[model samples]
Target: MTSDATASPAGKIALVTGAARGLGVEISRQLAALGAHVIVAARDRRQAEGTAAALRAEGGSASAMKLDVTSEADRLAAREAIEAAHRRLDILINNAGILIDSPDGGTPAERQPSEARESDLRRTFEVNFFAPLRLTQTLLPLLRRSEAPRIVNVSSIRGSLTHLSDPTSPVYPIRALGYDTSKAALNAFTILIAEELRGTPFKINAVHPGWLRTGMGGDRADMSVEDGAHTAVRYATLGDDGPTGGFFFLDERLPW
Candidate 1:
């Protein structure tokens, strides 16, 4: 990896999952902009390399790797690549995710008893809950090598059980059990990992990027991709004294 032409990535490296397009792409771009040599991870080697190429052309240090978060082989290879190149990973942005397409108006809780399918629930959990946790666990040793490690789980506001339960909450407009519940599980992982890492220099946090205009976010989203990425970037680059095990959107502490 080449050194940053402008700012030094503080001599750190970062890996962002699902960086082929949408929020993942933007997040990888922004991290590179901050001077970190980023690994633009995606399921497709072609797209991943293309993204890394774009970054390199623009004067950022980056490389591409195939990382299907659900597959152990890919994850292991990604870790090995990072270890070989940087010896340690300073930041990890678990930005890959999906939103199951549901019928308009959502699967209301009242109707969930008969409408929700086991397969739908399973897939959502696999991507949103288990995947992030598993990746973090696999990369812990490499992260521990860094002077300051940061893990930013790209979550959603709907993931908050607190907000979902509040009838008056702004998030009430959107509801999908498969997606929402999976995120809730992810948030729990974030809290537990933060607790496990307490007294250490590492920081782990969940962030709500808000509704964004991505393939999953649809067309009605109020926020741009740049706006959605702000919180993730902030959490990824927090100072030594920054809050850990916290839920946030931009700078605001969110209810979990």
Candidate 2:
């Protein structure tokens, strides 16, 4: 394990999953800019390394790691690597997620809850819900070693139950059952874990990065990747007085 003096100046270490492209890439960049030694983890090692190289070229501290969150072997390897290097992790951003049933391309012309397949649901849950929960559990020990640990689950506003049920809600008319439900489960996990660690220095919360013009959000999205990344970056670097077990978009708390 590396000594404290060898760690980042802030003594902060961050690991971002699916950091090769899109919002994950932007999130990694922003975190690195804040002086955190960022780990740009992705299933593809080459892509991950490329992202890390770019960050380093821009004068930010970053490195690459191969991590397929859905694979147990990869998860164990990631834990071992972190333990061997930093010995502690200050921030964990679960930004890796999938949208298999996106409306951009649907068999029935529009993706709907009624027409969603079981396979799609299971696959979506595997990445969005289970992977984050398992990774957090696996890394909890390292996180405990930090003076102030922060876990930011990158969720979506579509997971909001209130918004989904209300007729007036913008997302009420559009339903991507698999993706939305998985994120809702992730939000629940955040709340449960935060409550379990309530009195501790750990701050766990879910943030809805606005619908950005990423591959998942599609070209019609109103926000840019940089704009979408701000919320997660803010929460990931939160102070000791920051709120936990909450759902937020920027500074506003959203309905569960």
| Model number with the top lDDT | 2
Model 1's alpha-carbon lDDT is 0.83
Where model 2 places Cα greater than 4 Å from the true spot, the runs are: 1-9, 103-111
Give the per-residue lDDT digits (tens) of candidate 2, residues 62-116. 9999999999999999999999999999999999999887644112225567788
Q: What is the lDDT of residue 223 in candidate 1?
A: 88
Q: Model 1: which residue pairs collide?
A: none
lDDT for residue 194 in candidate 1, whole number 0-100: 96
**Top of the candidates by TM-score:** 2
The TM-score that candidate 2 achieves is: 0.94
Cα lDDT tens digits, model 1, 1-256, are 1112122345578999989998888888888888888899999999999999999888888899999999888888888888888789899999998777353223234335257778888997888888888999999999999888999999988899889889998767566778888899999999999999999988899999887887777677788898888778788887776889989897688999
